[model samples]
Target chain A: MEGFIIALFVCMVLALISKYLSIPAIPFYILAGVILGKAGLGVVHSDEISRFFSEMGLLFLLFFMGLELKLERIIANPSKVLKGGFIGLTIDMGIGFIAAYLLGFSLMESFIVGAAFYITSTAIVITSLIENRKLMFKETETIIWVTIFEDIVLIVILALLSASDQNLLFFFAKIALALVFMYGISYYGKEFLVSILDRDDELPILFTFAAVLTTASFALFLGIPETLMVIALGAALATTDPDAFEQHARPFKDVFLVLFFVFFGITIDFSGGINWFIIAVICSLAIVSKLISGMIIGLTIHGSALSGLEIWSNTISRGEFSIALAVLYGSPVIATTIAALVIVTSIVGSFTAKYSTWLRRGIVSRSRKKALMHRPH
Target chain B: MTLRSLNLPGVGTKYEFETDKGDTVAIFFTKTGIIQMYTLQKGCKTPSAAEMSPVEARRLGNILTGAIIEADQESVEIAFSALADLRITIHTFFVTPAVVGKTIEELQIRAKTGTTVIAVCRHDRNIINPPPTFAFEKGDAALVIGESDQIKTFEREIMVN
Candidate 1:
């Protein structure tokens, strides 16, 4: 109990520091977790309660992500979401897989690692956009489409990765079933559920929680990971009147998310057993590789080099998704490595976002001056 | 009727009107800022979209071409007026205490020396053309527009020694 209190306090301090400094909180939280964890100070240990909260955090993260994704918006630009997203994911994941494989990871490990890096943190991107006042910029529309696309792609990848060694047709059929069930619930089941909430004003929060848990459990029952299902369900819910449902659900989502980050910090092992040098190298490579891949794909699709660079820089931020994947399937060595990489990437990405605009503006101004100097008098 | 049109510098179109059958001729400005004059004509038809709203078609016809032309004009003007440029920089030492709750006009007067408060940066956000009643806060960076000599005087007076 005393240890838990200390852990919670540490997390709060780290969160505050990160917020004030305009830095990613993930690294500090992970550092705090490492210090309190069994591998470092041995103040905090992996327990059932912590594990449970961590899982809940993952559930809520997905739910919130799902809520943000409005299906109607995707429907309006299906090709931009699906085709562009798929291509971007394929290229990014392929590059990452090759890099991991060459670094001595097995095919399966490489595949998982590659998949981890393919997904971008929409939360980070959105926050950066708002901070920079670029949310309404011309490039923002493209970024939103691509980011949403990447999220859906992550869901599909998670689904495929978690599947057993079944035939392709069987795997596809299962996915189809999941989709039908998701659509059925979203379309028909939501109205009945919403009406019940309407009758009872206090029931909305309870209903949202119940719906998330039940859908996640159902997905687990069907041999699918709850993470994908939770996201899908949240997405389904998002299709409803966002203002009506979101206001109630947002607080719950935030609380669970904070707990998730705290739990993530507490579980990470920062023992000397892992090679810090290797981790640093891998983290740098991961950020650079992902940034390059995103830039290439964004430029190809959007036809703007600057827009591509901005998207690339923003998308390079790795957070909960990578850690979640690492914890679920990776060995402690792999998990620690991935966690360290995510922390580094997030910090670098945030700083990149903070300064990228200034740098771009400087370049533009210099070029304009050059043009003026060369003008025929 | 004698109708005359002139290409006004730094402005768009200007039309002048005169009439042979003028009787107590009076000119009135329309709500849309266009000047109207009563005159007799052989025939009149409302202008087509091509003539009335050429900007829309020009924008659609080629955005890059339009942007290039606009940019060229701006560059030419800036180059020609380069000597008239006045740059000013003001530093506030006790921004939070001195500036907060002070009106823009008050700050302008306090800063004095002819410096114009053009913009303020706070919390990593830039506020341009800040209102008169806008209060300054801690860590706020202000962009003052004035001559170098005036800016130096303004900073010395308003900023903490």
Candidate 2:
């Protein structure tokens, strides 16, 4: 507990540094964690308390994604959601598997690795997008919807992976039950919940936290993914009054999501236990694979490479989710390797978004120039 | 170098500032003092966005493209440093038959005080630099420009008690 508090204090100091320098703090917080954890100074351990905060962070991240994408919209566009979500996962996982297989890992290990690589870090990508003011871009909607779909698939896999004893069939059965449960509560129970809570500011926030706790606890009891369950809770409330829920729930979500990134950093083993060179080569390919996948997805929807670039630019970073997968599924070597990949990819992905505007303009102008040169004077 | 007005029908009046750096920004100014900014993506329009504060709005307004805001020269932004400098302030005195029959030259307002009445808002119309022959009506609002003290004194002398 003391170690966690000191770690929080360390994050605060790094945050101040980031502010003074006028840079985003997502990367800095992770770097700070690495420096403070056993990876560097051995100052802060990923204690049980920190682990709890980390899990809360994922729950809140997905929950807000639920808030933004809203339940009605998600249900309305099932085909669009599934297609957009499938593109990035299919590409990254394919790359992850092939890379792992070529590196002589077994089929199961390869599948685990591919699944882990399939997820883009919601925390880092969403945080960077908002901070850089790229949240208003035309492609932002396309990017977010795709990510929401990815997270939905991710949680299902997480549920399956976490409960090793349960077969996929049982998980699917539970999911069907959960969906029915979600539909009933969101459609029928919304008004009652809102009336019970009223418009009290603090209680709405408390209720949001309670909602997370109750659903997360139930998910554990049911052998389902807690991440998916909290998202369900948020979706239920979103179906009621999205604005009120957003106003109440955002602050709690923000604080914990920061802890999620830091906890991700603390878990990395920068010591010789991890193989850096092999992971670096493999991760670079994964990043390229993500971009190619995004481009394909964008093309399929918008019928233009430029639109594809939009999806690619926003969806390239694979952070906390990949790290979560690594910890759960990877052998010790692979898990540590993935941790390194998360840090590198997040930095690369965010910087891509940071300068995406410049890139877009340059490409547009160059294309125009080429067209002009070909035209008769 | 040039400002393009992208005043969409449903959207707010948007002004694009094309910079020498080749990057452009679209600022959507609403009726209320709210500013919505976009990165001006080439092929995309109407991106769902966030709002910036009035201070930022003003800064963006000033720096982006030269918007000649007539009243913003000695604006509150520079009002403290430009304290002694000439300032433009509109003092709308509610006239109840007070100097209702008066004309500008007859009033000798400029000769008596350093304040200049730049325009008059009568009902829905604005008559800028109203001719000396122009008569002041019951509800005429005078837009004056002068030093701070001069403006106050001019208001006091002309406004009905």
Candidate 3:
């Protein structure tokens, strides 16, 4: 209890600092975990209560992801989403995977590293776009689509990683059956579900809580992974009343997700000698890979490299989902590497997102000056 | 003017159109009911944007449509007194897809809500006491007189599907 209280207090302080600076609180929370946990001062340990809260945090985060997934919207604009999504996947994930493989990590660790590298921080990206008032720009739309695409791909990655050792066919069939059954219930009970969601009392929240808990517990009972089931449940519920579900579940997600990040930070072991060279290389590549993909997407979709620069500037951060991947599936070295990546990229992303317009303007004027100098007067 | 709408995925729908001044105006209607309007002029490097609450947007809409004209409180009260005595008021509803292409007879507005269509205001002209067979067109504003509850009924039944 004392340790938990201390951890939360330190996190609260860090959260305040991050908020005051108008930057992301994610990397700060993880840093607090590192400082307080065994890696630094050794003040906090992973107790049962903290562990449970952390798990809730991860589950709610995934559930929130499911709620936000609007498949129809993605389908309606498949061209842009696919074009931007594939460009990002090939370049970002490809570079991340290859880089990690050459750095002496195992195959699975490399895949984890690659995925963490590939998935940019959606919260950081979206929040900064709104803050920077860049939403009106053409490239903003492409950036959003790519994030949505990464989210969909992350779900697949999580499922594959979780069920890697299971009998592949049976695992897939079971998940498929569960998803179909959930979808059928949501479809047939759409009216009933909406009616319940529209209620102004406690039932709506209770129902949401009960639905998530029941799904989690049931998945555990059936020996299926709870993460995928909760996400499936969320997606099914989304077909009914996603906004309402989000409203009711947001409080739980907010509190629990903080614990999830901090606990993840706490568990990251740096006892093995730190690989500074590899970490530096991976961090640099994380930024460069986004630049390459952002340029490609911008040129193909928006017809301008400056717009690509804007996209890369806003998307340089690897945040919550990356850390979630590390905590869920990474080895100690992988976790440490990802923590460093998130901390560095997110801080850098905040500044770049803020000043990207100035950067673009600088480049434009510089090019124009060169053009003028080369011309005969 | 034709409005081009683009889906902004997680944000909202963006409706853009070029004005007579050759400036492109994009209005974003977010799912959370916030409205953002951006105007980009030719040769301008950055667009000018403004954010508004849904209520503010509606008030601006009323002004744009000339529904709420600039009148002092006393003058507005005097104008309302003419209809206040009989508990009757006027409501102006723009023609929506649900009511467009339907004749006054088909809508049975009088029978359904005990309201009378006093006038139909189109872009160029206003028609007083339109005939029963008069078919409504898009962008036409029907000015009807009725009690408050009857006006609500008309809005519920006819103005929207």
Candidate 4:
């Protein structure tokens, strides 16, 4: 308890600093965990409270993601999302998986690495775009869509992974049944749901909180993954009043998610023989793969290589989801490697994202100079 | 006149357009009902951005919808010439307590003030050309037509105390 309190206090201070610097707090939280946990001073251990807070953090994060997953938009433009998403899945995940496989990790470990590698930190990417004021740029749309695509893929990956150990058919059947049940409730109770949400009293907040917890608890009761259940709950609520749920649920997600990241960092065990070469290679591939995939997305979707460069620059940071994947499913070695990958890529990605414009300009000017020089005299 | 909207995933939807002034304006309506507006001037790299709460955004929307300088109340008054020298006017009045629950025939409005009650707007329902036996209710807006002075007399005597 004392350790958890001290850890949160440190995270709070770190969060303030990260906010002040206009950087994503995710990497910092993980790094703070690395410093405070078994790998560092060994002051903080994962207690029940911390673990529960961490679980809430991950659940609420997915719940928020599910709430924001406006299916209409994706349905409205299926081709763009598919093309960009497919290319990204193939390139980033393919590379991460292939490289990890070749590096002597088990196939499952490679799959986990590849999954983490494939997902760019949506939080980091979106925040940087708005902070950098790149929202108005033409490439910004493609960048945003690619993140959405990644989110969708993340959900699918999570589902597949959760169902891997169980009877696949039964798992999917249960999921479908749960989904239908949820949708039915949402459809039938739409008016009641909206009325409750519209209320300014504590009922709305309580309903939102209870709805999530109920879904999670019910999922456990039904032998369904609470992760999927909460997401389903969020999606069902989204049809009625997503904004209300988001507003009411945000306070819990915000505080808990901070602990989630911090505790994830704290729980990382690095004593399992560090592999620097493999870690360096995977980290490098994380950047290179995004660059390749982002460029493809740019050239094909946006018709500008420079736009691809811009997308690549913004997306290189793999923070929250990557760490989540690592913490949730990864072995100790995989966790340590991913933690390193996240710390390195996020810090490097921040600088690259910030100066991406300058990088693009330099490349453009250099190419123009070459064209000028190559012209017949 | 043309607007492009993009889904911002975890954020909300963003509607953007280049204004006639050649400045690009983007408005983001977040999933949580907060609104963020950004304007980028031509040839500028950065945009000026402002965030508004839902209430603030709605207030601004109301202003933009011209709620502040609403349609003039007199615009509701209709005037026409029945004869070259005589002008008839139509107007609306809020039914106060003095006129509430009073039937048109009982009030004898047409006989006393020479004004015909054209309609009674109660809540969302409008009673057009209300009958003589129609009773006025509190909160009803009575639409009447007559000579200007007669309408004035009707308002002074019937619509209010």
Best by TM-score: 3
C-alpha RMSD values across all candidates: 18.5, 10.9, 10.9, 9.0
Model 1 misplaced stretches (Cα beyond 4 Å): A82-87, A165-182, A199-201, A270-272, A369-377, B1-161
lDDT of 1 by residue, A1-377 (tens): 67767877887887888778877777777777777776677877767777776777778877777776776767877776775576667677777788778877898988778877666666676666555444324455566677778777777667777775657677667656886787787688767766755755667878777877888788777766788777777776766654445656667766666666666666666553777766776777777776676677667776766766767666778777777778778777778777777777888888878787766677678989999999999
Once fitted onto the true fold, the runs of candidate 4 whose alpha carbons sit more than 4 angstroms away are: A374-377, B19-24, B29-161
- lDDT-wise, the better of 1 and 3 is 3
For B26-72, candidate 2 gives per-residue lDDT tens digits of 56664234667876544454344557878877656555443234442
Ten contiguous residues with the weakest lDDT in model 3 chain A:
A126-135
- The 10-residue segment of model 2 chain A with minimum total lDDT is A129-138
lDDT score, candidate 4, position A57: 91
Task: List A-chain TM-scores for all predictions.
Answer: 0.88, 0.84, 0.97, 0.97
Worst 10 residues of 1 chain B by lDDT: B71-80
TM-score of each: 0.65, 0.68, 0.81, 0.78
Q: How many backbone clashes does candidate 3 have?
A: 0
Per-residue lDDT, model 1, residue A97, is 82
Who wins the lDDT comparison? Answer: 3
- Arranged by DockQ, best first: 3, 4, 2, 1
Candidate 4 per-residue lDDT, tens place, A1-377, comes to 99998988998898899889888788888899989998899999998899999998988998998897878889999997788889999999999999999999999889999999889988888878776756667777777778888888988888988888999899999999999999899999999999998998899989887888888888999898898888878888889888788899999999999899889888888878889999999999999999999999999987888889998999999988898898789998999999989888898888888899889889988999999999999
Query: What fraction of native interface contacts does model 2 preserve?
Result: 0.18
> A181-258, model 2: which lDDT tens digit per residue?
876887898887677567665677787788778888888898787766676666666677766666666787778877
> What is the lDDT, from 0 to 100, of the residue A38 in candidate 2?
72
Candidate 3 clashing pairs, residues 3+ apart or interchain: none
lDDT at residue B73 of model 2 (Cα atoms): 34
